[model samples]
Target chain A: MLEFTFSVILENLLLATRWTILLSLIAFVLGGVVGLIVLFARVSHSRALRTLTIGYIELFQGTPLLMQLFLFFFGVALLGVEVSPWVAASLALTFWTSAFLAEIWRGCVEAIPKGQWEASESLAMTYTEQMRHVILPQALRIAVAPTVGFSVQVIKGTALASVIGFVELTKAGTMLNNATFRPFLVYTLVALIYFALCFPLSWYSKRLEGRLNVAR
Target chain B: MLYQMNFGDLLPYWQVLARGLLFTVVLTLVSTVAGIFVGTAGAWARTFGPKWAGTCVSIYVELIRNTPFIVQLFFIFFGLPAIGVKMGEAEAAFLAMTINLGAYSTEIIRAGIQAVPYGHLEAGSSLAMSRWEIFRHIVLKQAFMKVYPALSSQIVIVMLGSAVVSQISAEDLTYAANYIQSRNFRAFEVYLVVTGIYLALAIALRALLRGIARAVFPKG
Candidate 1:
């Protein structure tokens, strides 16, 4: 067996970390765009649209993300389209993240008193205009801290993309472990990298939450 | 060949799926109970125990919270044996789930404990209740009332997360699905059915928890 140096292992792991970061960015941006649409439907005036969005959110939220990832990986292929692991993982995480972000933003939107909505209505504003001028701007402020906090979840979530054979941080750890047989050192480094990525966002979220509460 | 969805192929594997469903439910239950026990203790330590203990608990919570559950499960199952500690796949999954949920519930329960009014503690003290007695009757009871909904939601989340244990060869619901797919080459159908079962399970678990809460805290 060939000898493996510690620095060699670290170097390989760091290279894979780039994919993890990139995948997270892709999922977050796409999920945010989709989540905004889900939010509109979730809080819309039409009862049918509201009900449809609720079911959509519940389906994603109530199931394990691993299952969702698996479904996308295989389900997409079953459609007679050639599916890459990268494409499947991105699609699955986008849906999953959007479900959560929509729910979180809904709470912020609902937190705005009914009076605000009524005031906008009395001003002869259309529904879109009311939301545009009155509700979302206010909700956006409260949404910021929690949205930032949930991004930590989004980052941690990218780790699951590895299950579909995406070559990200966690997958890289397993690959290195197979080569080096240093499960302890390898997994520890993997956890440390995740911690480094996540702790700052969590800390910032909490600080933002505290400041928001004080302002209220 | 164009893929045609064929869920009928899974009918013969009903027993396998049933066993997997049972295993997943059992795992969720065992971990939830054990996890809450650990959480209650950790919460107490964080709230009223020594400074060193509180600091240790804080570190533990942050460490567990920041990482993915899959990584935590992988570390326990694959990493610990490197140091002479060993366990069966099921046991490792159980331990990982318990520890993961414990860290979360500790934070949740501590917030509940903090929400109790200072006056309630004084009232219990005037009644000649010991500290432990006050905690059990006055503080914890009220705290539970305040945080029960949040705690219930966390339990459901953990139960859903239990799906990943299949990766380690523990025969949970997802494991059965994987096994059937490997045997019959019906990955799509098998996963679809298993995913449905999971959705039903999530709904049922939430309802069951809510029912228990109603019975235990009728006024709340």
Candidate 2:
């Protein structure tokens, strides 16, 4: 039987940490872009657009990320096009993140008092102008905390991308565990790396939430 | 190249899909019920128990909340066996899900408990109500009413999150789809079917929860 050594595992685990962070960044940025568009559609006055956006959100949020990964991974291949796992993982996370981000943002927009919208309209502002000059500023303040908070979810969610063969932290841990035959030690390190990545965000989110509450 | 989409290849796999859907529903119901009790208890401990108890609850909530469900599943399924507590994949998956949902539901229920106003408790006390009576009649009732929407949403999320258990080969909806895809090589069609079923399940679960809420808390 092969004995386990923490030092070797720690080194590889640390190296894998970078991929996790990178994946999270890509997911967050892309999700944010898609989420912004979804948010616009969700809150638009056009009933069809609003309904369509709601359907999109429900489809993404209602299913598991694991399923989404499988769909993207194999779905693309079934189309007679081979896509890299990185592309598939990114696409999957982007959609997942957008659904959540859109919801969070819609809540923030709705949190702005109705008076603000009316006030902007009274000033003869176009819909876009009203949103840009009036509603968005206030909504942005309300959104900051929750958006930051939701990022923690997105980061944790990136771990699921590993299921489709994306070589990130959890997958690295799995490989190390297979080689080391040290499930407990390997996973503990994995959990700790995750904790190190996630705790600061959690704490920061709480702090931002507290500040927002006080400001409100 | 415009590849032909052959959804017809999946026609024979209806039984597999049906079985997967059934497993998904069963897993969701089991975990949701288990989660509610665990969440309520944790909320109670944080609200009415000692300082250490609250701290412990907070730790549990934060740890579970921040980590991916996949890792938790692996920990329960693979990690526990190493410690000599061997369990089948389904049991481990259920245990993991219960723990994960319990932590989240704890926060939601705790918020509900806090939302119960102080005046109600004082009124119950002045009316010669015992602590248990006050909790049961006033605190618990009001909390449930206040947190109905949140609790309902959490249940839906838990139901969806149950798909993660397919990783451990739990034979849930995703697992079934995976099996069918491997057999038929119609990956996209299998997933499309799985997605539709999941969307329907989510809607049904939400509607069911809403009906229950109306029955339990009419004014809410």
Q: Which candidate tops DockQ?
A: 1
Pairs that collide in candidate 1 are none
Each model's lDDT: 0.93, 0.88
List candidate 1 segments past 4 Å from native.
Answer: none
lDDT score, candidate 1: 0.93
lDDT leader: 1
* Per-residue accuracy of model 1 over A48-85 as CA lDDT, tens digit each: 99999999999999998989999999999987898998
lDDT of 2 by residue, A1-216 (tens): 644578878989899889899999999999999998999889888999999999899889988787788889887776778889898999999999999999999998998899998988999998788788998888998898888888888888889888888889999989998897788778878887888889889899889999878975
Candidate 2 at B27: error in angstroms?
1.0
* Top model number, TM-score: 1
